[model samples]
Target: MTITSSPWVHPEPSQSQLHLDVVPENVLHALAAGESASFVPRFVSPYLAGPECLSLWRMRSGQIVDTPTDAPWITRLMVDPRVTAPVGVAGFHGAPDDTGMVEVGYRVDPLLRRRGYARRSLETLLAVAQGHPDVRTVRASISPENTASRALVSSYGFVETGEQWDEEDGLEIIFEVSAG
Candidate 1:
């Protein structure tokens, strides 16, 4: 949703608390390099180095090359404030398009799934989108086989508009809802 704001805020500490620590270029590089333990952001848990997260870092590190350092809002660790450790990753696909459409992506560690972290991550992204002036619509392109994710989006009032074939993720159901 083109969250132009800096220092993205996290929810206040509570049992359900989750925060995002922007994964900087160097950290992305190190994660992409497969050395999660030695990464610059020592507070980031190694769970963030999961295969999915590794791919995200590899791709995002390349994305920041010619872009503004703070512009992408690309990837952040979905952290558990109680222990200050990451349990997942969440961020927009990119800035909003001409139609004010922006897509959201989030992946919680497989081992840590079903603890409501995914829901919290989606809530955070939706809050960001709703507050951004440029965002009119938020999108979630989910794999049809992913019932949990499908249910998640639907519960947020997103309606399925159609479907698309993705080279990497195969067929996906596209859901959209007004950002506000």
Candidate 2:
């Protein structure tokens, strides 16, 4: 399902809302305010520090999830950088299966704990995901022990699918939200 034929595409946001073009400036201000870190491995994975990592971390492109199957309609969650402090990021993954399904995985900035940024970011990303014609479902994989993250997604209509996994990061909970 190419984006061109997808019913999800729509007009951009209002000037008041944060969008891609405003991210870099927002991030720079957030860094200066000490509200968030630029790109620390302790907060993110060391593997995310490469050139591609910077692009992903900055939300400059939709490259957060790179797979041959994810060539189209995959987008990064944009942050206000200045106001957001980027405590977390919403990473989107998708494929061209014509089912309009996408997945969002995220992480938060450790310093800006309990500020509801993750929830807000996820909400915004979900709205964007729903606007795409090829995105009928959005999914997420959360660490079971991460109570805050679990609560955030669950509150926004995501439901656990009884799926669990033991990755290098320990237990993970899979959640999904329908586009409708």
Candidate 3:
């Protein structure tokens, strides 16, 4: 099903509490000061202080980094409903490429996994991508050993396309979900 027409795309008033705040280019500095450049820190997760986040922020578009909320794709903190702590991080690699393909990625805190946050966040991300006319496909690259991840995306209509090798991630199985 297309994200736009998916029931999970739109969260109910209560479940809509999760917010996606774009991580700025200097996210490390922002997080150090308890913020995300443009917004105050809603929650703090250990991932925010890791090199992974720094790397992701560095790859962000300068223009989008300046005006984070407007970024087509960037790492974001997934604030819990209580609004006092971060549940996880979620985002895309960037805007759609020339081939209209965009990569979707996310990671929920280990303690918070299996509670449906990843699925919800993914649905929301898909909706955001579907909103853009240029995004025709959403790709997810999962490690061969990550059965949970492979199963997760597959449940949402993502089909295995092929595989590729990465220096860091090793062998990865590529999955693609086409826009409807």
Worst 10 residues of 3 by lDDT: 1-10
Model 3 Cα lDDT, one tens digit per residue, 129-171: 7777888999999999999889999998999999999776799
Residue 178's lDDT within candidate 3 is: 88
Model 2: lDDT equals 0.52
Q: Which order, best to worst by lDDT? A: 1, 3, 2
Error of 2 at 90 (Å): 1.6
lDDT of 1 by residue, 16-99 (tens): 557666776677777887777765333456567766567777777777775654345677777675554677788887777899
The 0-to-1 C-alpha lDDT of every candidate, in the order given, reads: 0.77, 0.52, 0.68
What TM-score, over all chains together, does every model reach?
0.86, 0.58, 0.75
Question: RMSD, each candidate, Å?
Answer: 2.7, 8.2, 5.3
How many clashes does the backbone of model 1 have? 0
- Kindly list the per-residue Cα lDDT of model 2 for residues 125-180, writing each as its tens digit: 67767666767888878787888878888998999986666544567888988976
